[model samples]
Target chain A: MIEPFTVLSSRTVVLPVDNIDTDQIIPARFLTTTQRDGLGRHLFADWRRDAANRPREDFVLNRPGAEGARILVAGRNFGCGSSREHAPWALLDYGFRAVISTEIADIFRSNALRNGLLPVVIDADSHAWLLAHPGAEIGIDLRDCTVRMAAGREAGFEVEPFARHCLLNGIDPLGWLLSQVPAIQAYEDRAACRA
Target chain B: MTAPRTLFRKVWDRHVVVPETAATPAVLYIDLHLVHEVTSPQAFAALRERGLKVRRPDRTLATVDHSVPTAEASWASGLGEMDHAARYQVRTLGENCGRSGVRLFGVNSARRGIVHVIGPEQGATQPGMTIVCGDSHTTTHGAFGALAFGIGTTEVGHVLATQCLLQRLPRTLLVELEGRLGPGVTAKDVILGVIGRIGVDGGTGHVIEFRGEAVSAMSMEERMTLCNMAIEAGARAGMVAPDETTFEYLAGRPMAPQGEAWERAVVEWRELNSDPGAEYDRSVTIDVGALEPQVTWGTDPGMVMPVSGRIPAPAGAGHRKALDYMGLSAGAAIAGQPVQVVFIGSCTNSRLSDLRAAAAVLRGRRVAPGVRAMIVPGSQQVRAAAEAEGLDRVFRDAGAEWHQSGCSLCIAMNGDRAAAGQYVVSTSNRNFEGRQGQGARTLLASPLTAAASAITGKVADPRPLLEEGRRIA
Candidate 1:
């Protein structure tokens, strides 16, 4: 079940790499499990671990001051490969409430949104600003569709109103769609009558 | 007045269940939904949690591909290693499909194979249809003039509960291929050339319509190979307008319409092409005749060049990083680069024709010493067809491991993987870092290219081998 999301403010981690694909977010080897739990432990497993399976201290997630970061500021073309929802599942499991990137892939964006993970698209300047200032607290107001940086700057973003409604209500779109089945049937009936 | 309609617009407009309003995106009805083991388990769980069943079970198909081992032992037992997580995932899919009254092509089933390959083989994928799958390569169905794209696991759950997807219409891009493809240059080479020219994110936010003589000349399977990697170009989907080739391929398949139904379907499909004066948001043309067999030199599919070309100098940070990871130097020739492993499989190029092309090169030759080569058919049906013609024996005699069908060594989720630090020439789609295995470098190529490389143990061109064979004959 997805939690209702409205406003979130938290310290953000900066991952300044472009085209961070779903495979990097969650490797295919770790995808054998059906359950979504415990995936955060394997997030970026290849980059986070050495060949001997030791944790690499140089990686950003392993660095100090990166703990409990609820927002991720990433590079362009984020989530660029595969249609695996494991990418967003791992992010949400890792305690990230939102992701800020210059661009997001089509399937990844929809997946993240449906899973209650906010995918915020901002201008390159704002992205650079957020990356330059590490551990900065960023604010996301989904109700207003704007992201506020720690430096007192604001950028507007867009989300389909229906997705927004679903997110705000903490409801799956499937239920709403089921409710509209009668209307859909009526439309089909009218088309058949016309034919 | 409205604008003239492209092929994408024609198909999409016809499938819209509800037009877009201020509050929501259009609810587009899905004609087919292909499910695989890797992404459908959680979707089934989600459905169970809500006490819901699949809305249209007949329109949905399930297969165990991504997490299934390609070894013959596993095929016989319908199981891999006893304690592996992949076994549980594959088993869970069978249970879910059985419980939901949805059909599944399990390991024991002769029709079982990769979702993308089996769909068209069964005649389930057709022109003017909207298809969705939890795997990105679902774009493979677009070759039949269908509007197919990948969806996330959450969206998979939604689609299971409702046979509709709420989607914003994607803009259309026209990719016109001019001239005829030269001999020995296959559709894999054509797509690789396009990705190299356009870069990785070139087609983002657009549905690409591949038009002109070259695409029209391609066989249905060849067109599928072209469309299978559209996601590598960041396109929402790739499509080729339906023609006589499309009709001929679907005529006798099991799920295809028969007799009068088939005739009526062909007439409607013929009208599915873009209007002559239709305008796309963006257009680009490539002379395919001028191209050669292409290979990826870096992590991404976009870092590709013709086999006769030299490695490019690093132009950006990404290029430098890709070069560093791939253990390649700037300005080096891609040819003569030694490869330790050669894989001829994956949805990209594992069809019957692909196997034939590879077999043609390996019939009288042997794999180079110290090279590990394997040939995995895309599906059980493909495997059966290849064996009926002794293609399997040809591969095995040439020192290649001919294995059962599934997605093997493509992503290396199963036991199949390249050794660390090994360079692999593969016929799979992606060559991203550690895509074949941890710390393994991969070069994406056609089956013919992979076959030639297996013989020489390097990035060797297949043209010389083809010419030599023709002269000998």
Candidate 2:
């Protein structure tokens, strides 16, 4: 079991960039550790940190008001490259509980959901509004599957029921699959019989 | 019972262990799981923490890549080139696979290579199978008509505890490539063209089946190249129907069925293509008769144009940001830009054929004085095959660095990287900022283009060079 992700209410940090790939989220050089902890420091290692290994003050994450923001508002096709769960690991560890975009890549969405990071795909209007209004208060309720923002504007998003249940209860999907061995074996046995 | 089914549906239907419901995903049994040093370490750690043994060791295969240094050719030194943490990740994978009874082609093994390359190299990938890995390019196996996709470490643990993944079926998108492909237009160009037509997110939440005469005519390796980059278009997986080319390539591989079993397998595989009248959620057709060799000018693969084209001005802030990261001016010619390095290896284009293609261009022609060109074969096997053909000598004679096989410079790990802010013409899959190195600018292209760029020390079209060879012949 992991941290239950039922609701999140926090100001959003806007990085209005499209197709923010996993490499940009966390470069491949930092992917050596077998463990997932301490990755928070390396989230967007290249974008957040400058060439001299100093934090660039211009980046949103280093700015004063950006502290404690839990929602990330990015452009379309966020998380577009590499299936490294490190992207979400770094995001979650760095205190981002949700990423809002108009289009979230397929594998990244699955990875994010399995890791308790809500990949919120909003409508173009809601996405545009979110991008235009960074630091705006937004609330997410996994039960209703809605992302509620300022001025009563909200968008309904989709999360597979099983993934939603897993996120809501802080249950890892592996345990559920582990419990269904008999079914898996039965299916394999049937294939053998047919063969 | 008589309804037509897509090839993807056929594969997905056969792999179902338990059907989906309102509260649960379908239990999809995996026939093969490819593990590499970088992604599987954490997944194995999770299994060890839970005291769970791998459910089906026979179906699981492991290799060391992404962290294995291409510079280290001696196993006796034993991956000594890797730093502490990278070495630890590889060693942990070795220990975990040893304890779990899974076969690991470790850094010490000659068969070691990129996970995607050796999976097919070993014939572990087959038609009508369900395949998964922790790397997004697992779609490479779909060239064999398998239902393959990448998963996260959590799902990797699930497959370890049970050789099955809980997945919601993805909708199907049919991409049909017709017309005659021109010279110097390899599979890499075809895929880049597809991604250019369809935006980066065009195939989001879908599995794409590449169909038509152009796909039918492609070699198995070429098809792998095409399917390998479907992820660049946000596709979960990419597929091409198994035919003569597929079976012919699989016939003598290590794990393929032998003799009578192979005959029976062939009979069954003959039916693996989609049936007539198969329904699809979406369809698109691209005419490749006039298609030219393509190159990516922007960071995203979708931001590409023909080799003779100019970089388009930014349409939005996202495009502007990509242009800034790429360090290219708007309206500038995509060609003739200075380059410091040229990389000709990745899961996308590191096969023996890719090596041969690059060697063909590099033969007798020296890489420009300032350019540092590196040619990394996709697998040890590919390296051996290229060496057998004297391809390595051609690269070396052309002033390129010939290295051992691994995902070198493609992911920018293993110290195989270009310096910051330097431009590189690479034959890898992604061109995201800091991908080849911190602050490095990447212009993604095919092996031929990379070879030409190495010779010119700048981005250059390969058509004239290729045409010269053909005309001489």
Candidate 1 per-residue lDDT, tens place, A77-173, comes to 8888798999998998988989998998888898999989998988888888988988898889999999897657998888878989999889888
- Range of the 10 consecutive residues with the lowest summed lDDT in candidate 2 chain A: A186-195
- What lDDT tens digits, residue by residue, belong to model 2 across residues B208-276? 999998999999999999999999999999999999999999999999988998999999998998899
RMSD of each: 1.8, 1.4
Native contact recovery (fnat) for each candidate is: 0.68, 0.88
Please give, for residues B83-187, the per-residue lDDT of candidate 1 as tens digits: 378888888999999988888999789999989999999999999989999999999999999999999988898789887888888998899999999888999
Q: Rate the local accuracy (lDDT) of all candidates.
A: 0.90, 0.90
Q: How does each model score on TM-score?
A: 0.97, 0.98
The 10-residue segment of model 1 chain B with minimum total lDDT is B74-83
* Candidate 2: clashing pairs of residues: none
Q: Look at candidate 1 and give me any clashing residue pairs.
A: none
Number of the top TM-score candidate = 2
